[model samples]
Target: AQSVAQPEDQVNVAEGNPLTVKCTYSVSGNPYLFWYVQYPNRGLQFLLKYITGDNLVKGSYGFEAEFNKSQTSFHLKKPSALVSDSALYFCAVSQRGTNAGKSTFGDGTTLTVKP
Candidate 1:
């Protein structure tokens, strides 16, 4: 079965410091990995994706992720955390089954950035 795991319920960091939100997945064949950020009452915005090639992928708002195929991990990282960056983050895997539209989301991780 295809699945994802996000062990942290929340991650706290100071503004201007580097931050990371961890994620891990399990899938048959090659999987499409993604990271999304959700603001309060707002739909998730796509941060990045691992489709093919290059382990390192960059995305909107200075966010980036490294797809570790060997470890089955795709962790989101930012060089500097912003107070505005504090929000709910979800790591997802695309399931190309009949539910291709389905993106299995991790139980979101709330990021709190202290000013």
Candidate 2:
């Protein structure tokens, strides 16, 4: 089984400041980690993923995430935040080789970027 956790329910940041949203996961085997953003009344949008490559992976809208095997973490980061970046972020994980493509997701973290 695979699971994901976002310790923080909300993250507040100022525009032009760096921001990070924490996430942790557990899986039986190799894992596929993903980050998604959901705007108001819209479906989730893919941001980044960490399948099997470098520890650090970049993603859309100037966002990035680093996969830490030792810590079992995949925290999302942005160098400079923007007010428009405010949204609900989710962390998802799925065990590799799983028959179903279903992914376990975190409760979600609401990001509020103040201008």
Cα lDDT tens digits for candidate 1, 12-56: 999999999999998887889999999999999989999899999
Candidate 1 off by > 4 Å = 96-99
Give all candidates' CA lDDT scores.
0.92, 0.95
lDDT per residue (tens digit) for residues 1-115 in model 2: 5789999999999999999999999998778999999999999999999989799999999999999998999999999999999999999998888754688999999999999
- Give the runs in model 2 whose Cα sits over 4 Å from its true position: none
Predict model 2's lDDT versus the native.
0.95
C-alpha lDDT of candidate 1 relative to the true structure: 0.92
TM-score of each: 0.94, 0.97
Best candidate, lDDT? 2
- Superposing all C-alpha atoms, what RMSD in Å does each candidate have to the true structure? 1.3, 0.9
Steric clashes per prediction? 0, 0
* Candidate 1 residue-wise lDDT at 105: 85
